[model samples]
Target: MLVDDAVALVPSIPGRRALLGLAGAPAAGKSTLARRLVAGVNDRLGAGTAAYVPMDGFHLSNAQLDRLRLRDRKGAPETFDVDGYVALLGRLRSERTRPVYAPDFDRRLDEPVAAGLVVPAGTALVVTEGNYLADDGPGWGQVRDLLDELWYVETPRRLRERRLLRRHVRGGRTEAEARAFIASSERLNARRVELTRPFCTRVVSPRDP
Candidate 1:
């Protein structure tokens, strides 16, 4: 989805609770767009006014998932530590002092590292980007309650799948294996995300112009 629309939508926020959310499927470039938006916002507003916190950090540890025998569904909603993520969002929204610690997901290891992230106070806007940020479930609604507005990044399913497949291949999966995983795993999640698209304040479609 278009970055400028997402950016423009952020300022209309009701005020004080200056949090924005970006939601989409995996490899939809949600994180990349979040970075660009932060840079653009900070470029105009000066430093430290904008920050990004992602939901991927709340993934349950591989070990923990292994214990639960849910490791195969890593990207599924139930696979994440949803409660912990909600708590962190609450803290960030309130601008917690004394460094609120958060888990950080290490892609190389495919696990979450505890207390590896700290969000200090004075961050005027917390732009969170994640696949489940717009989910309609009770766990995800907690994030919605803390945000002033939310936007969904809209991309063609074919293009999204192409990008995700390439990303999986680059991340070490064989081409055939990557395609199969995306078809079965990523496709399911994308469909779920599409269902929740209506919850977004706006839908953004990026153009090359």
Candidate 2:
């Protein structure tokens, strides 16, 4: 599961204004899977036919979080600019418009980079990957109505932890810190994330997919 594509989800993408959602808990392979799906779909559909706009980029800026007094709570659902994510989805779903610009998350900076992304015209599909794409909050409510399909991915809890720990260490955390962070922040979010499972069109567990 650590090194594989969800081929079941690959065939779901279509050529035209299709909005596909990829949802999963932190470090459960959603980003990796989404990337694979995008590549698979693009290869199948040909050039300029597929694009990716992730929900993570819609996260509030560190400065904005400081202003809101929520700096310590980064990555929690409220830490994101939910309305901004919904707005971007709206733009993609619109008809014959100019190429839509999207924000992207910078792992090195731990911040979102705005207008550093573009969905070229004739791009038939937009794949949005995130932890809470299927959340039922008012901010998240706009998604299901907007997207053509939603998929949820699940990794075994232990595997998820191991992958998350590796990511943290690779991104500059000490092994101890990575383990601690997974035990604390990641697990906390995982429980909250389970609340989103029922909302998806399909649930893709590692073995099943």
Kindly give the number of clashing pairs for every candidate. Answer: 4, 0
lDDT of 2 by residue, 1-209 (tens): 31123223333434337778888898788777767667766676676666788888988999999999976566778889888888889888764357889999998787899997899867777778888888887687777888878889888889888888877788788999888777767787788788889989888753432
Best by TM-score: 1
Please report the candidate that would top lDDT against the real structure: 2
Residue by residue across 1-209, what tens digits does model 1's lDDT show? 24344345444333343678888887777777777877776776667667777888888887888999986677888888789888888777665344567777777777778877665565566778888987877687677777778878888888888898887787778999888888777888888888888888877753310
Worst 10 residues of 2 by lDDT: 2-11
User: What's the lDDT of the predicted structure labeled candidate 2?
Assistant: 0.77
TM value for model 1: 0.87
State in Å the error of residue 93, model 1: 0.9
| Candidate 1 Cα misplacement greater than 4 A, ranges | 1-17, 206-209
Provide TM-scores for the models.
0.87, 0.86
